[model samples]
Target chain A: MTDRSRTPAENAELALLLEVAGTPKPGNVDRHRDLDDLRFEQFLAGSVGSARGLRAAADGAPLGGAFERAVRGMSRQSGGNTQFGCLLLLTPLVSAAAAGDLTREAVRERCRVTTVDDAVAFYRAFEHVDVAVGDPPEGVDALDARRGSDAEPALRERGTTLWDVMELSADPDDGVPDTNAAEWIEGFPRTFDAAEAVLADDGAVLDRAARSFLRQLAAEPDTLVATTHGESVAESVRERAASTLAAVERTGSLDPAEALAEAFVDEGINPGTTADRVAAALFVALERGLAV
Target chain B: MTDRSRTPAENAELALLLEVAGTPKPGNVDRHRDLDDLRFEQFLAGSVGSARGLRAAADGAPLGGAFERAVRGMSRQSGGNTQFGCLLLLTPLVSAAAAGDLTREAVRERCRVTTVDDAVAFYRAFEHVDVAVGDPPEGVDALDARRGSDAEPALRERGTTLWDVMELSADPDDGVPDTNAAEWIEGFPRTFDAAEAVLADDGAVLDRAARSFLRQLAAEPDTLVATTHGESVAESVRERAASTLAAVERTGSLDPAEALAEAFVDEGINPGTTADRVAAALFVALERGLAV
Candidate 1:
């Protein structure tokens, strides 16, 4: 609503801050709550620390390099991997925004054009923090991110672009959906859709973002939950989110959502991938003039 | 400690985040609470929006212009004037740090060198938000910040530099102290001292910042409280903070601080000036390699 214009980097950083500030986001760290190991302040620190990388992305730095730098900066906080997937999603979006087009098509085009060097840098980023990415399928063990820079040779030999790697991981036959990867191949459909939802909703912008996060969680099984637990557990979490969101809709209250948040935190069921997508959605919304 | 080195602008932005992230910061907006009008997310938005101004300062822009830009950006959030005083303190510090030294002497020199244009810019910044500055002295009505750019002629006619204006306002004959202005004249003593306290304290960095905030509040009456609710109320708030700090020191527990925070918020007493100093202190701490 204010007249101040923000650069792509500023909007990306704002998106990170707004996403974490949205309260009662089930199983994710928000302003009011934190998981046992990750405090809300760490998310704040991660958001601040990632500014350089965000700026670099906005300045049209290569996607993998920008994403890796952002992850490295984010890992400066004690709470590890605070926004790894978020940065992974935001980097390309920021680049697209910087290119004067923040559309899904622009981001998808950027993703499609990523090179082998970008893929190598993406793997190298894993050296900075412990991300719970589970094991790669048996044949692709050599390309695991945990190998860090050691996987660069495999990536180069196979001519695997970052986009190719994303496609490989997008929808595994094992039933564990990598939503972050899926966004790459699918033109970031969830992020764009969620941005539209955020713009359509009323009340505070952050409150709208919390609602958007819940909607996304309800619509899709969070990949982090699927990877850490099982597909069924992820599905059940989605169902819980759906019912909680329905109750909120029915009563015009977020109280039910808060209860669900508490239960999810207590159960240690973090829907981190959904949170990451919401962060990207926030960026899109901000770029499209969704006011604070 | 983080191995990554940060620019002055990055440190300043991180300081804003860390200060707000610290919980149980009595009478101020922190992670766990909000005032009736100002929400924690607004602070986050303000911090994100202020980055360009912070960067401008670090890049050696004129102090008043940089500060005005920062305040203008911060005002983009619906919560008006979220960090005006904090930005006022940080702009010169960032300029000093960008000059390859973050010492008190460096910042004081920067403040002393500010021009009348800077003073005009400072006044112009007032137009962007509703700052609760109360009334100026009878004769200085022409120079009141509420007059905005209209005060420029008076500033020019009197040859008043920003530093001169700050000195005029610092430690006024009236009981209410302008601590932010006093820092301009006194070489930022409180900010540096509190930075040392943050560095010496144990546990999380945010916990240290919260403790630092309490210590600062205990040591001096908050100027914002004095301005809003008279000097006696400010003094009483300081006494309460002192007692609460003593309880925390005696029991090695922050539980007492939480109760005091609830009481202070209920009473609608905000020690905003102290919070501003603490944010500046956090910037100093971060620049000196205090870990997140």
Candidate 2:
């Protein structure tokens, strides 16, 4: 890893670009895969323009307000939901990076400072993209992200901070955590661990990232995969990934992974939530001195 | 193309990013293709960082110094050549964009004002990247770009401006023009024409870019191809591209171009010069409101 210093903006941009550029991630919109209505360039533009506001979130700016502006900037350029998951993951990490501590404790400290206004701003950002979020638990209908401005008064009445809302959705008791909410409630354990994995792997950074992604998917069934495809299908995909990774480990060839990627893409089983984890992991890696 | 107002920096970044993200341009190191040493992420980093310096160049900062700084910034992130050709083509155009007149005459006017110090700085930028420029013309060995700082005094003695050097290298007498120098002396005719073509093409922005690239490569034997492979080989490649384009037009499919791309990538024959021109064209297209 090169020991180059970086501003939070540069780090945020690199994390997002690296996320999209990793090839054969199977089922995901990679460099080679341009989904209809959601091309790769839109993602590139969103990531490039988002660095400033993401950095500001870590530099004492309100996270929700910064996120809203960044999302708006992204929407103006892309007019698509390219990197919504990534922005969800990166905003807090960017804040953690700016705070000069990448620890889970530090990130939790950052998240804890969020206010009802922050929750309102976070919901406002949802106006820009069609993110697939699970329904809020019973009796929280008024706080639905899809409700837009109508949710604001409810959020204000409850005096719920963004952290409180994340706690509501983290679903820790379910054994399979909701990705973004889990990051907030648990102070981003998976993100930090994935970064550790990035540093331990030894190869070209992109190749390492690709390998790490397979490991990530194999280790945890993606939340997005579960959301779109049923839980059984998501589990099956995870098992397939595990087997593919085992073969690569045995033969030291990336060929099997390529085949697995083809199958995943053909079936339209995109594990986008896992890809978001990779993005956050990469940010941690960069902050810890992973070279380009 | 976005109706949204853009600063010169935003325009430059978008153009550079879009240029590299144009997929299946084959043989060029784009989003899908990473050379052993030069990864796609590095190119993204280089382009992201250079926007500021390019904007400075257009904002009445001495063109040479600004260009040198921009190249240096790219090198710092990439640790290798990434967008030297693009920057050379963009410097004048960026200046034109900042001047609020992207017309050929306005661009020429911008070029004309470049000072000898600008020539020195242009030479300084050469230290950062291994740009594929031919040898200097006879009797002007003192103006060699590869000479770095050693060429400075000679440039000073001759009172050469950056525009003057480009004029010598433009080689209007040669029937085949150097893409970079030719743009300088002729006020970017091909670049402008390519932009017009982009606007005229109807499809997704990337598809339009890919089509424009094929057309550009078909129209000219890329100087880079000619330099690496013999002139005969370059001519043969151009002929193949033309026929491929003809087949695509006849069938209304980019499938034929995909086949051509496969052949070129297999042969390690890259028409990089043509790709650079396409980038300039895309910029012009965006500047003129060719929606993505």
Candidate 3:
């Protein structure tokens, strides 16, 4: 989405900013909506600061440590969970870029090296913000970030790596499949595929992002929506998105998508999981030089 | 615009983000517009990075060196002039915050201590981005940053410190008074005044900013608009802004301002100087703890 001559760190920063600057992102903190307790500007600061920190430490730190540090930085700066989902998705991508490759294999390789200490730090970072992670699998409640430092000992005793946590969270057949978890476990299939989509599509980068977001929302109900609202609400939102995209196809305009976004916001339904996926997609697109 | 529980640095970052996030700014790369070369995301990245860098160095670095480093840091990340005017205004204000006093006197005292090396570094930073600066007064052609290193010796020989340059630029009665210069020379009267305005306003901070921006534009023709589009066009834009504000006053709504913004964007008119003033004002408001 920017000039290709920039460093990977610079592009990573740009990717984070673009992720927040996406207008009409509906109930999420896009340009149009600034929540009473949380401002969009705070999110902007957190995202940029975290992206820069991740890129700077990507080469030296293991994936889990880097991710924890980035998240901690954002929490300290923003005083909220402004971009926890984004940090989870972007950490490995930045690591891959620092490794001289931007590929799913590279990201997975980086994730494979995460240690138990990294998991402890990751849990510790959660004390700084109210990240919206749903309830964990029944037995793995010890892995819950909201458990704070209390979960660290069990994580240590189980020798449960960050990747193990991702694998558990990523099981699509499970009752709850986090978009971030799915990307981590499946070698970031959707992230890479979305990068390819951006390359194939023709328009401004923001417009492409909007289209990609709709496609993702139409394809599946958002996990965040399901968690915060309900399965029925999420399913209805997905169906509405599909119909809106179909209308866009018929009318060749985004007016329907805009209307759909307004309705989602009016209903207080935030497809945050899908928004996180779009951030990951935009990161991949920027990393691979998909935008001219 | 954000929770007051944040640190001064975090508040500074929020100010930068809020400044640029103002929507429908009309041809100035607000939320709705991204130029062919410069994206709104780049501006976001620039503002956040600069704010962070400024705050991080505020306690130790001399005001001039801090300003140069922040600008250089932004250039490294964004590769453009997204907030040159803003950096000029914020650096001194951040210094004041770091000095445990958020006052024009404190900022002036900070600027008064800048040396010749800071001046040279300031010019050196100019090489990294295409900042929009007007020509200097007579006998100061050698002070122009466009001359690059060629001006260094002259600056040293003339003993023209950064403060002296600010004094020259701050002459508000000058044919081309820089908004940044006016803040520096006049001890930031306008910035402080706008902060008072925000404190008195009864609404969302973003809406306060929108109203403050329109008022600032209506009060005076933006020098950036004058430099780029000539005095007559700038004056006409200011007149339209005045009329729009009058309509808003009559109707108690921003619809008139929105309509005027649409027309301004269509005509390629950007009141960038007013936008910079608004950023300075937001910084002052944040520094003074003016928030609901």
Candidate 4:
């Protein structure tokens, strides 16, 4: 029943919805659970609100402008930053798909061609919502996202393209990789791989997405988790995901994962970056003919 | 935090999402519950898929063509007929909104102006999914929705515009009013009134939507339920809803409604048509500055 002819913008929006609808996605808002502040309906509103920006990306708008517009739209909900990182990853991929190919090389080419204007617009997106980002590395204070549009002069003076900024943030000094930034630098390896995992799995598409999310989280520490908590907590969370996934694989039951979901929510350990990557993977899978 | 600047298409899409996300809606799919066949994610997919059709409606496409396209897109999900009635109600409202006004008069004018071609297209949409529609009157056998495109000649011969078709179906021979069709004939009174109820209520927006849904169901028998199950059963369902609403109002708790939700789902009594009206009401509310 998959509608493969859907526009890239439609697929991206579906990915966002599917990611949030996936159940027992430990520590993140899903169909069956909600955080204290962020409810599931807010995510639905965010996806609906972001449609214009997604269409803009598919129509070949500048990356920064599209992302900023999407972020601003997403923030229309009381839940401030429901899909900031997801939009960050999807905007370029949608553009790449709109360009006639969704290959890694195409995405890489798109990322590589980003201009300093794109970088400035990306910083401007930060002004729309409160994203929990770690501090910029030593000498890059002028490019901190918290500086918002105020950093535009410095970005122009340094001749920093969006690609250059991604490279700067791809590997942080604290040893926690900025997974979304790394996707830009490395052409979305995890996204493509997890998409394959989703296509290979069984059951509902959203359930498949939940498993892919667990796999992604198990494979690496979530950047948002590392930034919000600490590297140690992030690593432990990844280990928990790895163990929970292994148990589910052996038993063929989601019970263990569901229990872990409750514990993770209670502990306030949200692997949001991993969830974002899973959403990107879902878009890739859907675009490549994964059934709904 | 509501984005009042969203297009009519965007508001319609959000209304679909919000309608499905509302919890504890007896006998219908919601964020916390799914029917044996239809999951929450399919509704999400339907909303995502229907965006183009919604845009078409907002862009002044022929009403039948827009509704047919939206229904076709919605059927992309495996769960068939996820939002058929909703699209039926929303199509004209979106078109009215697009025509520089969302007033009841505007909607009435749009409905009254629907062409025979629009009636044919509306009939054609039935071919895309198996909707649970009642049989047409004896004299109107050739206009049965189950006849799909085969009824087109009859529609053209009778010079039946979409408005005329709604008028024929609005008050069934059985006394079970087709709420969605009734919306067309009466200029969407229940939709506008239920929207006011949603806006006047308190907690989460989805919860308010759920309450409004209950009020609508309590107020009248759901045409779909009456068609699938007997009119007596539909009347009983409405009585249960009324009592549940009264209890919830008296106790200031949703526990009774939640219990009723479980029983209604177990009995296989889905008030899908009433739910569709709630979605239209939600679209009206969202368009008229209901906060997210």
* Candidate 4 runs further than 4 Å off: A1-4, A173-175, B1-4, B173-176
Residue-wise C-alpha lDDT for candidate 1, range A15-80, written one tens digit per residue: 999999898899999978878999887888899889889989999999999998898888877788
lDDT tens per residue, model 2, B173-244? 333457777888888999999999889889777778788888988998888888777789889989998898
What range of 10 consecutive residues in model 3 chain B has the weakest lDDT sum?
B1-10
* Models sorted by DockQ, best on top: 4, 1, 2, 3
Q: Can you write out model 3's per-residue Cα lDDT over B45-124, one digit (the tens) per residue?
A: 67655754586556667666677767766664443788877778887887777677888787777778888887887787
The native-contact fraction of candidate 1 is 0.61
lDDT of 3: 0.73
lDDT of every predicted structure (CA atoms) = 0.90, 0.79, 0.73, 0.90
Ranking 3 against 4 by TM-score, winner: 4
Model 3 — TM-score against the truth? 0.86
TM-score of chain A of each: 0.98, 0.93, 0.91, 0.97
- Please give the ranking of all candidate structures by TM-score, highest first, separated by commas: 4, 1, 2, 3
Candidate No. with top TM-score:
4
Per-candidate interface DockQ score: 0.58, 0.34, 0.25, 0.59
Q: What share of the true interface contacts does each candidate keep?
A: 0.61, 0.27, 0.15, 0.61
TM-scores, each model vs. reference: 0.95, 0.89, 0.86, 0.97
TM-score of 2: 0.89
List, residue by residue over A95-170, the lDDT tens digit for candidate 3: 7876678878877777777778877877876876787777887767778769867888999999988888777777
